[model samples]
Target chain A: MVQPEQIKQWIEAGLDGARVTVVGDGHHFEAVIVSPAFDDKSMVQQHQLVYQVLGEKMKEEIHALSMRTLTPEQAAQQGE
Target chain B: MSVQDRIKEQIVSEKIMLYMKGTPQFPQCGFSGKTVQILQACGARFGAVDVLADPEIRQGIKDYSNWPTIPQLYINGEFIGGCDIITELYQKGELQKMVMAAQG
Candidate 1:
């Protein structure tokens, strides 16, 4: 089982500027990630970016991961 | 036919296609169940494949869409996100618009 902090760290390491909040019970996780990289991307593209960052962990460690990807601007607007 | 070919045919043939863990009436996964509810709420007439019932499709779908999860949605042969994206889109009323456009 992967820790939430590990997930957070991986995302932060992968994206240039990212703020990720992860909550989970080992297997299933939910993430709210704000990143400059997400700007101008569609929702599917935004998610694919995150998925690419996680790499093989997405297939092996994480049983389920639901994400809310946002641009820094959108995150600020939403007060996230 | 290859699995990719089969998936291509499935997605293109259905205006709104859902590859889920189980049927709408009996969703095996919570995410799948929630997705079904969202689609029903939108009054979307979608075709669904219970991946749990078909091992080939269960695995083929992930590769087909390059997405690592179940409960994936496709509209007009395009890959939409999974449960999270679907819920967000439905909440923002974008999903309804897409469904309307597809049905028209």
Candidate 2:
């Protein structure tokens, strides 16, 4: 079983200054990833970057990952 | 025709196309089901290809899009994204606007 923290660690290692929250039951996962790298990127590009972090885990271990990716500005705007 | 050529033709022919796990009326995957719902919610009449039924596409699409997932969406031959991106767009009411723009 994959721990949420492990997923968080992987993402953190891949992205700089990323605020990541992941919750899952080994098979399925949901993540809200806030990162500076996501700025000026398209939604697909943002997700692609996060996907790059997980790599083979996404194919072999995790069944699904529903993610909400945002930049710091977008995250702040979300609070408004 | 080569698979790449065929894939290109399909996208070129359909203004709105979805490559999903199953048919819109009876989706196989939850992500595919949700994506179908969102597309319908946008009032978009789209063409759907059930990737599960076609092994080549099931594997080929990942290579084609460089994305390792099903339920990929295209509008006006533009690669929009998969379920997550679509869900975010839908929540922001941007999906409907995109659909309308594609239809125009």
Candidate 3:
């Protein structure tokens, strides 16, 4: 149901300049996200932001998600 | 006495262990990949065994931890949790402290 492309679309819609990598077996996903919107938020809040982007897709299709959210600075520090 | 027991014993015998989908060098699944990244970022020495490579260990781990998931993390003979919990812990900076304390 919640295909990878839909995730990409949702992220692109929610954030102006967000980099998202979606990896999983369809039902479960591991997302590596770098967004300027995550600059001052706590990790939980960052994850919540991403989830909000997904909207109702989380309940309808996505079963599980393992997220690695970082600000652009963090991502840059990680050499990504 | 059983496969589960053997798996438990293995986990208990190892100080820092990860029962993942594939070896640390070649993680077969995305969850396992993220687990490895978090562990690496902690800068702790760890051992990772590929459950997918062995059917016995794969099923045994589920029974050993009573957790039906790959990328299970164990520290000092205790089951920490799966990828989500690990990521959460890592984000909170608790994982680094835990690994450091364990190493010490």
Give the alpha-carbon lDDT of every model: 0.92, 0.89, 0.80
Q: lDDT per residue, candidate 1, A5-69, as tens digits?
A: 99999999999899999999998899999999999999988998999899899889989998999
RMSD of 1: 1.1
Q: Model 2 lDDT vs. the true structure?
A: 0.89
Q: Where does model 1 exceed 4 Å of error?
A: none
Docking class of 2: medium
DockQ of each: 0.81, 0.78, 0.11
How much is the lDDT of residue B46 in candidate 3?
Answer: 93
Looking at chain B only, the TM-scores across the models are: 0.96, 0.96, 0.94
- What is the clash tally of candidate 3? 0
TM-scores of chain A across candidates = 0.97, 0.93, 0.88
Write the residue-wise lDDT of candidate 3 on B72-93 in tens digits.
Answer: 8899988787787788898889
Where does candidate 2 stray beyond 4 Å? none
- Against the true structure, candidate 3 reaches a TM-score of 0.60
Against the true structure, candidate 2 reaches a TM-score of: 0.95
